[model samples]
Target chain A: MQDLGIRVLLEGNNMIRLLDGLWVTVRISLLAVVISIVMGILLGMVMTLKNPVTKALTRIYLEFIRIMPQLVLLFLIYFGAAKAFNIHISGELSAVIVFTLWGTAEMGDLVRGALISIPKHQYDSSAALGLTGIQIYRYIIIPQTLRRLIPLAINLVTRMIKTTSLIVLIGVVEVLKVGQQIIEASRYTAPSAALWIYGTVFFLYFIVCFPISKLSGKLEKRWQN
Target chain B: MSKTDYLLEIKNLEKSFEGGTKVLKDFSFSVQTGEVVVILGPSGCGKSTLLRCINGLEPIQAGTILLDGQSITDGKTKWSQIRQKIGMVFQSYDLFPHMTVFENILLGPLKVQGRTREEAGIAGEKLLERVGLLEKKDAYPRQLSGGQKQRVAIVRALMMEPEIMLFDEVTAALDPEMVREVLDVILELARGGMTMLIVTHEMQFARAIADRILFLDEGQIVESAAPEDFFGHPETERAQRFLNIFQFEK
Candidate 1:
């Protein structure tokens, strides 16, 4: 109690609860990221096609996700849709759905940019070598695109992790929610715990995000050089 | 037994950009086996575009192309398979930057033709040696000079043992000193009896290497003649004017 309310976390199972809360955040984000990456790559390739119908459709999807705020999307899917359709979804499920949709668009656009970023000569030379369209993509285009893509994609993962913090507003008991609960529950006993609690929460997020950012930076420098 | 005497032939070829500007218009030409044909043209005169169409790099607005006396549009002929026989080198020396010279040279033979490493490697190294690039096989494209990279690109094209090689201003992008190094390789190839279609601005080199000279203007062959005649006595006014520009430069 005297030591900046550090005793609150030191007390029975409060630290464990915070860790469990963090796991929820990690679970949702990682699941969404995985799905996003797989679908996003195909979507990206499709976006590069010269077909007009495909162009129009992908543009609308990308624009919709780009224009709408994630918080609003979450409410639309979780609360609005549920009430209108007489359906129910777990808060975690709704969070994952919204994030996956958002993340996929971001990742797809990155992939499309990467594919287009390849020099026109690369395709010409490969085609001149008698590589089929599929073979050209597999042998030359994808490898180069992957080299250009990995660092950016890793950065996207970090964004997803940080963004998962917003899910708590939808009643998901993620780390921030746990921290808030801890602050409210110990208000009388630990009047000063808010500072320490919020500080620890911020520290937790920094630890998770900083290494990912650093890893992406390191890869970018190494690969580009 | 042969359906056509020419190794490569194009009839009524037409190419335009977005149906707007015509790069090539009704071009009809042929390259015989063991022949070296040099195309000389002003900028935007369809010289490079002509090479690109021969290699099937451009979609024809209307035309027929015959390779090795066979119609390319026979439906039985796969374009990918057809391209394997028609090797092409670009002005930029479009080598894969991520690959070493050996990797770049051998990719066509190994991946496209499905040749064994032993078979392709021996041929690849021999061509590298011929181009005076044997020692640079392990070097990446970024590590090589402009001349060295162009030589590697030639080696890459030769690895497939193409029947006819299309050189689209291959030396145009090189420095003055490096240009000779690349032209020397083509000269040696011609001397060795490799049939070649070359688009080049190097007048002296064109005179030295070409069996026939095609003087192009506005997407048509203004004059086609033996190199000696084309250089010494250009037939058409266009050819004379084109050659005069080079003489004035000297």
Candidate 2:
């Protein structure tokens, strides 16, 4: 264990700081994911409208997000936009904001696919039963869309958790950054510490994401059959 | 206009797609109370479209549809409210797959009509019993056969207690052995004086159940006559040709 340099993380609250940093990543991811789900569902509904203007607008927004990388977005929001717009945003806040924007776009597109996949007859049958527009959505449209969406959305959650690593580049002091700090501080004393620190970080991510993807797979198998 | 004796009336209906292909043109028809009118036509002859128009599924270009002497399609009453009075069953049963058989019937009565669950449950059970599907009330749609699903669809429509029912080839999706069971349910509804307008390819079933058969061709009604008169001696060459596709035995 000493040769592998696991000894460095054992010294001087390094593990504690890493765990605290993990907490930051989890908190930001959870907040952004919750908001993304709520706003994404509404955005998805709007995207499905028959209006050409709304369609074009949502299409542009989705394409912009898909085309631009998340790291560039983080830089734009954290550094460039903060200076230009005169908003004194914190590192954590900037990370959350950038992540929410990315997550919402992905979740909204997922919802749009789920909504459009439902056949036209479902709406017709609901209307023919005297269900109002809202009632049709509440009873028929939403229930079915959710069934088709939940498995895909669960996979998105794991993605968001893994992507939270990028927050370190924005100077958010997340898990990866904490590992780097531990490695830098012990470079001379524990020359091979980088391997163990990075390996521990990898295990940390697996611990968070493995169960979620497994759950998604089980749900998909059950629902499909 | 004074109150007409007809329960449902549609006049001067002209329906066209955005591409300017007209599906219905100047179509006028009326049904008295307790009447069962079966419409027969070649594929794409506006039989289904006419039913869809009456049920407020399709917007009409220039037409008036009145139910119980009140204009329904003139944008006066809400279509959701008016739709309760015009129950429609589609080619596929369209039962909400997530819901059970009883829940599908109860959804309209409970949510739209705002009836108590106890009242709707009793009525739902009775309707299911009438269609001989009481045992399957707790079953989801995927568990049922196609005929069983269509029967549930008819019961679902009937639960709304509409003034008229419109069936757009409700049995078209069923197998040959299954079609009889579905048609028999509609036949029972006809015998019990449940007013309906059916669009079906089953010629024998059409003759057996229709009080008046409207033979349609190219979005126009070529012949509207009593079942015997229309089936025995159709009035127009178009309707005769429409009938010639089938070699009617009985």
Candidate 3:
């Protein structure tokens, strides 16, 4: 336990590496979230269109993303697609692409559910009030949809942040990868280094995610009232 | 092109839901400016559908609707433009639940008509004051009673300064005690000389406020007459039977 103290974490610039890896994880997750939200909202609105072709196409895309595992998607994009297309893609870029694809579908479904849950009379009333389609969405529909969406979307964001830890398998050198390196290096000197290293990474993830989960809970309660 | 007499005209309007359930069939009616026309019908009898067709909420398969002699049923007609002059109140009192009463009243005028918030607010306050709900300006719809919500819905429509208003069983969902407040608001609007087409089930209220009553059955206007004649001597057996049902319920 003494060897598992602060000294182990501070050894040979190990702390710096873990911090850098944590930064990478946060950056990737945040970037993916922003992209997913913007694209997801638009796609979700498209999903609500009455056109059968549009609905069918979006359904296919959403189902494909939902059914496939994110890790497999990561490997397909990073290794398989790169080799097949003969294009070079970085590990971090691949992680972003994979997570954005996953997050967009999740967020889009969330948005679609929120938008459709609005009562039919609300649309009829807005139309009767001389509002154009755009005005109706902007002034009435979207605001209500967003209020229903924020808490759920925040939950999705936290999920994305935690899921980003999986990127280490693709060689992104995120926090888990950094922890693995620290554990590998101290394996000879400290037999219990793996426990401490993995524990630290677990705590780091909890430190970031706990607040967001709490926030999502608060928002859900407030909106429910 | 000539000066039109009627504020609204419906000629041979036809509407049907999918799976071949006809809601309105060859329905024709008209309302003179400042006239109150009440539609009386049984449930599923297309009274609500006719009002929906007038406001462009339901597309008609055939026939034309003219607001002030201008065709509003055509594809070329801009619905938003036509809707600007036609206000509607629903049975459900569909006030935007997320918005304050002030915001609900001000939204149509400010967003669609491009009125400043201050200008809209002034008009909104006047309408609210007229309804004696000026204190509820900041109150959300969920905080209001059924009567208050319906009143707010009426004021929200009036905020657009529409030439004509349509009420589709506006009091059907209100509590027994709350119904009078909403009816009173409509009565006040009628007294103010606003042209209105109302679909309602309240027999006494209809007899009180309606200039003429149109009895609809099976998607057709079976009888159109002055309120006194319609109530005193209904033309058709269906109309008599319909009124009898209401009388029995009362």
Candidate 4:
């Protein structure tokens, strides 16, 4: 048990490396979430327009992103596209790009669902009250949409944070990658290190995600009232 | 009546659904300034569609709608500008559920017309007071009873200071006991000499408030007469049959 490499995390600056990895994971996820929300909201609004061309184009893009797995998308950006296009994309940048692509599609669909779920009478009533299209959206539609959107978006943020572990596959050195490094380095001296290191990684992810899930649940309940 | 005296006029109005189901064909009517005109019809007879067309909520295929002598149905017409002068209340109330009653009323004046919150608030208070809902100004639509929601909806329209008001069966969705409160608001507006085109099923309220009643059938006005004449002695066979349904309900 003493050789189990739990000491590797508790003994020295090994834990500091894990904290640094956690920071990197959080930074990428945050950047992705912010960019996704802005782009996704604009795309979602475009999807709501009655124009056939825009509707078809957005539908295709949404389906493409949704159907493709995130890991494949990351590899395409990092390895496949880099070789095909002769562009030197860094692993971190590729991870950010892939996660943002995934998040934006999801966020856009959420926004579209929220916007369309509004009753037709609401639009008719606002128009009859003399509101212009922009005014109708600003004063009536958006306020209602945001109320239905925030909790769902927060859930997406949690999902994005968890999915960041996949970045380690492409050599980004996130928390999971750092845990693998620690386990590999102690393989001979601490033969049982794999279980301890992986357990810590799991604990780290839970600590980050559990509070967010709780917050999302709280928001859902508050909005229902 | 002269053209100048008419607050609203619909000439040869034609409306069809997406699949080419003709809802209104060659429908023509006019409401005089300060007169209360009530429209009565069976469901799907285009009474609601007619009101929606006049408010530009539903675009007409071919027609001319003149509001205060301006061609509202013309291609160049700015519908938002025309809607400012024409207030409309629907059967569903359609109050913004997320907003308080005061916010709902003030939205038109503040957002569309660009008035200050205080200015809209003052006018909103007056309308709320008139409807006896001054205290409910802070309450949301979900908190209000069906009658209160309808009354607040009326006040929301009135906040815009519209020249002509349209009611598309505003009390139709209410409970039987709650219907009178909404009708009372419409009656008050009529007595105040507001120009109104109302669609309703309440025969007693229509008799009390309407200067003229248009009985519609098959998307056309089968009979147009005073409320007493329409109720007591319907002119057309379709009108008599429509009235008989109400008689049976009574």
Which candidate number has the best TM-score? Answer: 1
Candidate 4, superposed: residue stretches over 4 Å from native: A1-6, A50-57, A75-90, A188-196, A210-225, B1-3, B75-77
Query: Judged by DockQ relative to the true structure, which candidate is superior, 1 or 4?
Result: 4
lDDT of each: 0.89, 0.90, 0.90, 0.90
Of models 1 and 2, which has the larger TM-score?
A: 1
Poorest stretch of ten by lDDT in candidate 4 chain B? B1-10
Candidate 1 wrongly placed segments (more than 4 Å)? A1-4, A83-86, B1-5, B12-26
| Every candidate's TM-score, chain A alone | 0.95, 0.92, 0.93, 0.93
DockQ scores of all models, one per candidate: 0.56, 0.59, 0.64, 0.67
Model 1 TM-score is 0.91
Compared with the true structure, the alpha-carbon lDDT of candidate 1 equals 0.89
Model 2 clash pairs? none
Worst 10 residues of 4 chain A by lDDT: A3-12
Candidate 1 residue pairs that clash: none
Q: Candidate 2 chain B — worst ten consecutive residues by lDDT sum? A: B241-250
Instruction: Report how far off residue B245 is in candidate 1 (Å).
Output: 3.2
- Residue lDDT tens for model 1, A1-225: 468489887778888988888889889989999999999999999999999999999999999999999999999999998999999998999999999999999999999999999999998988998988998888888888988999999999999999999998899999999999998999999999988888888988888889989988898876662
Candidate 3 ranges beyond 4 A from true positions = A1-4, A75-90, A210-225, B18-21, B74-77
Give the per-residue lDDT digits (tens) of candidate 4, residues A61-116. 89999899899999999999889999989999998899889888899999999999
| Top-down DockQ ranking | 4, 3, 2, 1
- Top DockQ: which candidate number? 4
